[model samples]
Target: MSMSDLFVFGPLAEAATFEAVTVRPLDGVPARLPGYALTGAPDADPSLVVREGAVVEGLLVSPLPEAARARLDAYGVALGHETFKAQVDCEGGAPRMAEIGAPKAGASGPDWDVAEWRDGQGARWALMAGEIADHAPPLSPTSFARQKAMIAARASSRLRAAATPAPATLRHEARAGDVALRLDAPLSGEFFKLATMRLSHRRFDGGRAEALPREVLVGVDATLVLPYDPRRDRVLLVEQFRSGPARRGSTNPWSLEPVAGIVDAGETPEQAGLREAREEAGLQLDALIPIFEGYPSPGSSTDHFHCFLALADLPREESWRGGLDEEHEDLRLHAVPFDRAMSLAQTGEIDVIPMLAMMYWLAHHRARLRAEAGSDAA
Candidate 1:
């Protein structure tokens, strides 16, 4: 196989994790191998498989250098026994073959002739599937299938740009100087729907719009906080039964997290953080420390999360079981020293990424927190 013939189908294919995996672009014409098919769960589109049967099809491309190949293999856990096979084939001028996941029997190849597939939704889905699979550890068949479905839903979300659009064009655009004048022009191709598990026509500008340069309005959403009391050398975390994780095959669906709540349309992040501290944990925050502001996942989710570090005086005798009666939040609060929280984070007792990040932040900021606590007491 020559450099030009190779094509990656999933997250590796997207070129986002190329540096992490140590794979590089090959310079040559791309050629396709005939007889193989790509298979994945009905929902996820991240990774693709090249299976043997009628004829496995793929492009022959240049091989990765030894170091790059090693890195890629480690990242994909491709080492060990013969889980997959590598072969040589020819593309533009030379012949080459590559290693890909083993294919499943009787799996059907994608219907490329379909307008939506041709426009590149399949490729995008494959990319997303690869990313999710990469992060998640190997699971049982049932669990893997569920993960695949989640990946598909995430890929098909309308919040992200479709796979095959022109490189220079923005998915949604605003005037250069105006962040609020966002415009949604007509989309050029179809969109994949996670909920329906199918490709469908996507019409941009579906809503009534005046012109290219139009005002875009967005509401200020809510903020959630987990407060840590430095003077007492204790941190507060809330435990709640989370249906989302439960549905995703988590063994213990209930989770322990910092205080959190949404910001009303016009409320500020600080206001929302303090309010949640009171509502969920029955404590008032003395000071608020900014953590980070960013989207949880720009590729799949629309929700933006702004995190805060709240310092407060927690009452030891106060009941830990508190939640809004109307919302049906069955919450249990835990107050542990900073070191113990870090130990929990290290042991995987605390698995949520946000919670882990906050724990680490506290580890570094504990001294200042303690000094402030002393000043307040004085």
Candidate 2:
């Protein structure tokens, strides 16, 4: 069915979420429905529950697809036990209606608009609903409500993509000396968006030198990397399926890597790295040595993957499974000898690039790390 046939009055009425519906002037539309009143300006109006005597009014739109319908059902509209039926107008027009729990007795409000409701807590809920629609189908209002709350809590501090600014005009110039590559950058007056991927063309001597259109350049503050020493002889490596690699049709879907996490705002990279080690692998780090501070892909993504070589004491018999319970992480720790770990990296069995780099770093510093561990034990 056409999107125009759907009419959303409450949380779903926001223009950002409901692009099909517009606020442009329309003529001869019906104005009243039982128990509701239209409040505020015509352009950004809201429907409020006035009184028992008042009536709510809205236009009839199109039927929603099964997917959208399921998402809305999961939104838990408080209309009680009313059977799902077609809402027929006096002129013989009808729309599908799923009766939900009715408003509380004597419930009334001076201001109630879908846009405002969405702006507060409803926007997050709606975005989650959309995600659920995309991932899990046949959404139930109860499940949507639960997932909405969970995702909102996890992403509260992170800026939304919509709120961030887009990249502006870019400038490019060639670097001097032996390197002939051009350095492409945003012009002085331009602004870059946070946590977004960007691509730009580089020009040298007023001529186009290179075109970089596929790189994802996002701006990030810091990164955290976790290193595990497996029971002294080996180190723990986590193997998990990554969607990013799978998207590229990699032969190996599972990656062997250390426990890592993003450094939150105002948090030190070392603190975050150690915290992630504890949370992901249940390792209490002895010392965190900074290996390097650099970007993961300087040509593409904005993530600055901070590398850390964390020293930890390993017990041979201890096999406590660990991972953050909230994040649904499935982690398996392998305690293998240092030599075998290096061999895996050489053969490409450990395919993750970051882990390979860390393993190589460990190879050179293994003796020093072991001596430090022995001193700590004494």
Candidate 3:
């Protein structure tokens, strides 16, 4: 019988990560694969691809028990990777055949840094992978790779929320122990994911309710910042075409909004707010005041929003366009006075929910902010 040996040149080479993901101790020997190199992008883990005259050192985990082999194969399939039989050198130049993933299209990065990723994002990924593996049966090796970023994005958001310290109210019955959460995969995905889940929770009146089957949209945790200059009584808003309104049959698809962006994995909402302010309005924000941390739609999605009120210096007249070209964002910055903004709000000219909320919040707090600025000036 042939041994089910696999050569791991990436994160799978780490003993802890391997065991955590594969559910087995990584018993292996130091080996080297000739004529191949390990490369990956910032968003992807290392992949071994053909690089002539390059010898990549790795670890060989072989003789996998049948069940474990099946799980491993499924993992590779879900990750959009494939294995090829290759010869590697081990102790005293002895050779062994190991399964390695074939390389794909990407600019080569540094040799895989497993520890760096571990300290930064390993635990969250481990949690996400384990959840996915539990429901991952088996799949064809030919399945295309997708949803790599989405998985990390969703995992990071979930982990962050878990670590966030918040006060609990008298609704103790709607607590962790009172609810059961389960994941049932609809399919492997890309930027968007639809998770079929069973949510059984305790009802009010000290009784248990029926377990409900639901779908969760695993969207990103994002930030939306409305840049304001309290002294100038002005706000910087961006005018851009939005798909949601267009799809909803709105005649005017070009909507006015504040600087906004998706909170990248491992990035704070504050960081996102500042970055978006620069990107969407070309203003370096001074102070970030968090308006709220909330879900866009809690009933059917995991999309989170960390709304902010960013204080910035807005020039009254400028010809500044913002947004990333790669993202196809053609935005115009509108530095409108606070009164005009309020008028727009009342007249329904500012229809986006987040923008409307920010305008109102500013309306309530504008006087205090200006007074504080005035004090600081003095």
> Which regions in candidate 3 have their CA more than 4 angstroms from the true location?
1-10, 13-44, 47-71, 74-113, 127-148, 173-176, 187-189, 317-320, 375-378
- Clash-forming residue pairs, model 3: none
Please give, for residues 340-359, the per-residue lDDT of candidate 2 as tens digits: 77888988899877788888
lDDT of 3 by residue, 77-153 (tens): 66667666889998675798877764453676766556677777677767555534543554333332334445666
Candidate 2: which stretches are off by over 4 Å?
1-231, 317-320, 375-378
| lDDT string, candidate 1, 1-378, tens digits | 223323443334434434334536534334444455544443223233444553333344356666555445444443121234444445445545555533233445453232344354554444443333233243334544444433443444322333223334756543242222222421111121121111122236544333333222121233658687667777887888887688999998888788887654224568778888888887766668898765555444444566998877765623368889987789988887767778889988887777888788777877877886784532
- Indicate the residue-level lDDT of 358 in model 1: 75
Best by lDDT: 3
Off by over 4 Å in 1: 1-220, 317-319, 375-378
Candidate 1 achieves a global lDDT of 0.53
**Clashes (N, CA, C under 3 Å) per candidate:** 24, 25, 0
Cα-based lDDT at residue 97, candidate 1 = 53
